[model samples]
Target: MTNLSGLQASRPPEAVYIHIPFCTNKCFYCDFNSYVLKDQPVMDYLRALEQEMELTVRDNPPGVIRSIFVGGGTPTVLKPEEMEYFLKTVRTYFPNWAEDIEFSMEANPGTTDPDKLAVMKAGGVNRVSFGVQAFQNELLSGIGRIHNTDDVYRSLDNARAAGLTNLSIDLMFGLPNQTVDMLGESIKRALALGLPHYSIYSLKVEENTLFHTLFNKNQLPLPTEEDELAMYLLLMSSMEEAGYGQYEISNFAKPGMESRHNITYWRNQDYYGLGAGAHGYARRMRHINVKGVSPYIEATKNGLPRLNAYPVTQEEAMEDFMMVGLRMREGVTGEAFRKQFGRQLEDVFGRPLQKMLSAGLLEHEGGNYRLSRQGILFGNDVFGEFVGVLTEI
Candidate 1:
């Protein structure tokens, strides 16, 4: 453990994200930094994680961590004792958490147990986000998910019984053979649980995934672009009618129940990412840990884990700020931009901003710039302009 107080006295992060890269099976459309394991060195991974945290805090001890998110290869897959050890390591390094720190962990439907949930809560985890991709059993199997619909309900019940009040469910749309009615039913079933937050992501066929191979071969039956767009609109309208606010492009939440940790990412705030394939940004530097468990564990013995690190340039940071901040419904604040870059937002990317405004993709209101409903639908076009500006400069 390092003297974190002195290290972070000048600059403290508002959030922290830990990645767990081990999962029982990988999903069809998934391309995250995770691995399927037959014989995993779980203990070695935990020790490497501890060493990484020590070195991370020494370099950048985050101040009053407002949110901490443990995501990935099903964080709940760890046995109860291993989970405790992991959580204990977290507390050991960054001891100064915010009074209202939103500690969240991503759990799969069937992996959660009453005892494990209890341990997580006891270890200061207040929120649990279940990766219940869909409510239909057939869809779950098609996506390579081991959990069924019954598992989702039982997991929620167990979480509630464990005294974890804040709950969220992840839902996916535009699946193989999925209808609008089926998507609606999934949302309906999720709402019935009264979860505070819901993450609805459209399926994308990424490289090296089963879905990608099937898609390339024309074997995967996917919805058309129009159908996918319709699904997005339906989800937006339904969530709005159900009293959930579209805080981010893929995230909806009841008032004040947004995933604080995720907000850190969308806001372009600095956080420590500690785990295999995890990414971190702090002191204007971005780093990604090695993706393989064995490699990361072996590298940690040298005190600093094997990581690919780089310093973010001023221009790149501003571009990232716009790219990520615009994802939020509130958009990017002019004041924040100026504060981070010491220049007016207009002066920085004046031409591109004007073009977006002229095209009705962006609107200026309340000293912030946000996307119009049209822009949200065609957000890629709006974001492309910024990317173009970055490339030119």
Candidate 2:
């Protein structure tokens, strides 16, 4: 196994991300590092993951992990016994978990059971995010999701029954043949559930997914740009009416319910990523693990697979900070920016900041820079400016 004692002694990681890459079936629009189970080596993969953690974490004993996110294939896909073993391995390596660590796991509607959820809770998972893409059965089927609306309800009920109160639901818009009315219905249903947090994302046709193939063949039916924009607006207004705050561009949550683990990423903080296909940023260096299970397992036997690793230049880090920070409603704290990079935020990005301000896309309030409502609508364009600035600098 890889030895991590040196790395751990150098710098302890504040967060950990573990990727579980086995799914019952692949979704049509998904391009994440996951596979449809057709006699996959589940046991072997878990064993390798445990071994990787033992080696990698030896160097960075995870002194006080602030957050731990277990994302898919589908983390809940593992049997209860398997999950116990997986969690046991994690605890064994990361001996020091933060007192208020935000441990989250992604759950599929159909795959989770109360028993498994209880095991996760006992294992220190406090948050559960359900992939409830839509409330309609037809849309679920169209997207190649194995679970139906009933599955969503049942899963939510089970999570609550299992004493999981800090929950989040993921929703999607801009689906094929989706109308504003249908979108409204979905939003209403979601709000009616009184979930603490929600992530509503507009569908993007990514490469290598079923949707992309259909799009290439001119067979995809998607909402018009204007319609999609309308859907977004409706969602925002509906969420506000239902007393949820729009914290991030695509995320809404009640006060104090924002995802701490995700905010760590947006804030550009250091985190450790484990398992196949996981990416991490720590001590100015960024790294990604090997993608495939067998490849990852073999590589980690020697050390962290680390297909790629690079240091983040100060200029690059600043640009990334600005781009990611602007996604939040509260925006980037000018003081935090200055403190982290040892430069005045405005002085560094003076010209572009002024231009964006003049264009009514950005504003400064309480020593922070944030996107205006219009900027939120055209956020991609605003973020593009930072990318251009980064390239030039």
Candidate 3:
């Protein structure tokens, strides 16, 4: 067994994440690097992304790409022609899309129409995840979402017409002025969609967002801890009852419909991160690109627009493995950890293991350590005990 830092790999990555930084509008709670689409150099940025793909593949070639996730402010904001051009660039540079590749794109409800969806499908996007945060129009408006419930239905119909059956929708709970009954109604509506997957996330007030401003000003009316917990429990129970498995902390899917691209991330494997403000992990190194639109486009003409790039130390890698791996309902496997790091899991983080197991927050069975039902709520606390225990913070 070896430490996590400098863990060697036998092949290149099979996953690619392309970022499209343009959005119609910024959501109140979003902190993801994105910009308004108006008057932006959309074509110029696409060209830069093409160049980046060429250079990145030349530097470190890819294997058969099993998954490609194009995420952004809203990937569907691209006009049909623009999307065609962008997808062509991807297909040209990364020629080896696996026969069963799961190509996914994030789209807002109003952004995706039949024409744009056709371009996406032709361009290799087989999965569409709509940003339908809530079904209630008032909550949608309060949260800065432009689309109403009608747009949600229209977008789903458009996606179906485009022949994308492997669909997923994103929902949010614990929103401002939202109630338990409101969340339940939203969940009921979402389940009626009969989609294969759903991503339900709780609201987090990150820095530099409108929500943060409201929180700082004491104007935000977030749900109490009890209510938030209740929301989580209700969603979990509802999804399972509806025949979806809670594969990850924030994601649920039908049988064999889990997000492979996301799993590559939780497994701490390598993947290419393309576009402005995108992050990548490869060859024991992690890198983030320049965040600004103009800066990223200009910097790419010279070379890759990397804001920060560094090889992860062994201890840090171990910590990352535990942190992300535990986010899954499957938890971390002792066997897989040994195969990856060449050491026993307990040999590295035995101290935290003893504490979590003793506290009944983590459980071990069949060579895996996963969160118990009680442990799921205290996941952060369990993960924290692993952090800074092996390396300097």
Candidate 4:
């Protein structure tokens, strides 16, 4: 495989990230490049996505894909027939899938119907992640979610009836007007579902979103830092008590139910990023697609719909390797760093590594460096220590 710059790839990307940037309505907290799916050019966008896939594989042919993650505004928003066509395009271009390939799709609870779930299952989507932000209906409405608690249960029921057992749900903390007890209740209900996987995150107020506007006006009643920390701690303990492993910072799973596609990102491996506002990395190069829907469609017809493309310098790649790899429980290995950069990890990052080790923020054992139990709470700081250190080396 080769990059767009005509350089041979060290290894072909085995993971894929396809974005579908249409939703029923924009969540107040979301800043992702997505539009409300009201009278949009749905079919035309699907064609453009297919074209991107065709052009992408032609330029940099993929190896046997082990994971394909379709994320979105909401991939499940598509009608049943539309979904059939979209999945068909995927099979046509990237057909060499591993027998145990993890084909996952992100869905909103209200968007999934039995017919749509059937089409998704037939299309090879074995894993489905629903955004179930909270169990309380008032909390869900305050966050601008279209679905209520009933939709969450109904969607899971439909997915199960369709014989899709590899299911996951997402939850959020630090929300507006949320209490510690509220979060504890949400976690309790979530555990009761007995799903294989859960992804819980804190709300971050980013620009260009309604939440940001409310925050700037001091109208958003977010939890205090102390409360937020308590919420996080509670979740970790609750998931552990329920026999779910906290595999990543914000993710938990039963054995073997962890998200492999996300591991690709945590390990800083290459993957094909298709559709509007997508980002792809391959052969030390990174590319970001145009964010707007119409602009992406127009650009893909003529050529690749890239907004920006750049090469990653060795220094930056090494920094990225440490930053992303350490997010995993297994952490980064000296062998992987040496293999990729042809230099000892200790030599390149000794200063930062020693500092973190001294501070009890990192633990090194058997040639692997992982965050200490204390460091997991302050992960951002631990990861920040590695940034720009490679450039000095």
Candidate 5:
């Protein structure tokens, strides 16, 4: 295998991610680049998005798109007509989609209606992930989620009715004032839904969020570290017993229902990111677009709307390959590392490998390195061992 170049890729990107930054309201825990949809320039932003897409494909033409994930504050907030135009714009540029393309959109529970879903299905969207964070109404309200449990049922029903049955929902644990029993109840209800995919994430009180403010004031009521660990263990066992495989750290899915777009990311492949505050990686270069909606719109009028763009260093790419690849239950492989960098995995990360393997945190079988049962609980620690370990390629 030849050494990979920062300016070249084995193939063009086959995955796409488009952001929609408007939401009905901001959640207390969300720090993503999003805004409340009040009087914002909706149509103008869509046009700007279209312009960005046009410029993006011109620079790095896509091959056959296998997956398209539309994420955001709430992508389903768009009116039916707006959604039609947005999806049409997407098809206009990268029209060569795989026959089995996984087109997914993120929707808030109450925001998706039958008409909007019909538009989505007609426009080639086959998957919908709803943000049903919790089943308890009080827990939902405390987390600043406007939708209730009833809304979750109705939203799933609507999606199924619209022929978009490949549905997924998100649930959260380690939330403020939440208990083990509460999380268990939520999981029970979620499993009852019989959805093919579920993403259960722990709360990480990130900076600039309301949770962070409360944490600083010592007013936030969060579960203890022990309880959080317990919650994780419980969910893992629960999902496994219910027939969902833990494909990734935070995601579980039935056979063949894993998120292909997300796997494109976890496997450290390239993808196109469009819309305000989007991030893209292609040909070993990474770029982040302007965060503000108005600024992104104006920036797109001129060019690709990037706030910053730079080639990823060879050493950095190797580090990323280890860090992200280890996040999956499948772990990293020596063959993949060699194919990407033309170097054996041990030659690049020998020290970290010996350390983690000695510590019984990583298990090696054949050519692959995966997290052991114990390593699964301390994944971040194992991943940290790979960063900054390479000083030269």
Candidate 6:
């Protein structure tokens, strides 16, 4: 309610993103700021995370934290007691939790067990998302995924037995040695799980990732761009057929099971980003923490572990609104744009909107601008139009 200044808070972030940067093994395609758990100081890093929370709330007091997403190399790698400590810090620092909070943790199938899942449930984690990249053992092994199809079933069973039902799984297409048929099988099995949510993505080779290294040498077997597009089409249709709503780009859910935490990002709202390499947006300021684990811990020892913090310009904010909001199925509303920036949506982005609308890449209905079926395929192009268009407005 109040900050250290003893006055009412100017703005309190209601969403939280905590990063756990340790994993059993680094996936070939993962470039996220994570380290192998082997010789790393796990508990020490967690303690630093708690200290960061204390320092964060001191200046930027929190409102009701409605969603907390613990993401990582693999959050499930944490021991049960470690998880308990982390959640306790979360509760202690941000006590004003919303009644229907959606607390989620990302798990790698082999890393999760009954005891750890039980710790998660007891700590208010109502949702669990497993990285079940594919159902086929060969495909799973072709990539660097250590968990086979069996780990997926066993993990789901343990999660269910722990009384956690709001489950989701992730699938990736365009992987090395993967076929469209393989993808379809993965989708079928995912749907058969009867879980409430699924996230399907196409593999992207980013710098510093093993996939990137292999790609440069033409050693990585990849689907052709056309094939990748086909995979996306299949993913969308399959999810819709399974009665799951494609709420955002790469995410589908059974109606109310949509990820509220992610919606906060798409809506361009504020949230606290805790832990190493986590990014936060609040009070029109976007900041990311130091990327290295030991460096992050050392940085937080004195104060906030900010690698870089900057205030967002009004133009950038408006551009961000369009870029992120358009990812949602409901898309961007004229009303929301007007409310956030006190400018008419058309006034700020008239040229891009007109172009997209004319090209049939976007559709305007009831004064909202949403991507057309075609626009979703060229989402980056559609977003690119709005990127710098606001600067001159």
Please, what is the whole-model Cα lDDT of each candidate in the order they appear? Answer: 0.87, 0.88, 0.91, 0.92, 0.93, 0.90
Candidate 6 residue lDDT tens string, 1-393: 111121111468889999999998888999999899999999999999999999999988998889999998799999999999998999999999999999999999988889888889989999999999999998877778899998999999999999999999999999988888889989999999999999888898999998899999999989888888888999999988889998898999998999999999999888999999999998877999998999998998899999999877778888899999999989999998876767799887889999999999999999899999999999999999988775555
**Which residues of candidate 6, in runs, are more than 4 Å off?**
1-9
lDDT of 2 by residue, 171-217 (tens): 99999888888999999999989999999999999999999999999
| C-alpha root-mean-square deviation, each candidate | 3.6, 3.6, 1.7, 2.3, 1.7, 3.2
TM-score for each of the candidates: 0.96, 0.96, 0.97, 0.97, 0.98, 0.97
Candidate 2, residue 216: lDDT:
96
Inter-residue clash pairs, candidate 1: 12-63
In candidate 4, list every pair of residues with a backbone clash: none
lDDT of 4 at 103: 98
lDDT of 1: 0.87
Residue 286 in model 6: shift from native, Å?
0.6
Steric collisions counted per model? 1, 7, 4, 0, 0, 0
Tens digit of per-residue lDDT, candidate 1, span 195-263? 889999988889999999999999999988888899899999999999999999899999999988988
Task: Please state the error at residue 61 of candidate 1 in Å.
Answer: 2.4
The deviation in Å at residue 155 for candidate 4 is 0.4
Off by over 4 Å in 1: 1-10, 388-393
Tens-digit lDDT track of model 5 for 1-393 = 123574347589999999999999989999999999999999999999999999988988889999999999899999999999999999999899999999999999999999999999999999999999999999999988999999999999999998899999999999999999999999999999999999999999999999899999999999999999999999999999999999999999999999999999998999999999999998888999999999999999899999999888878888999999998999999998988888889988988999999999999999999999899999999999988887633
Ranking by lDDT: 5, 4, 3, 6, 2, 1
Q: Comparing 2 and 6 by TM-score, which wins? A: 6
lDDT, model 3, position 144: 92
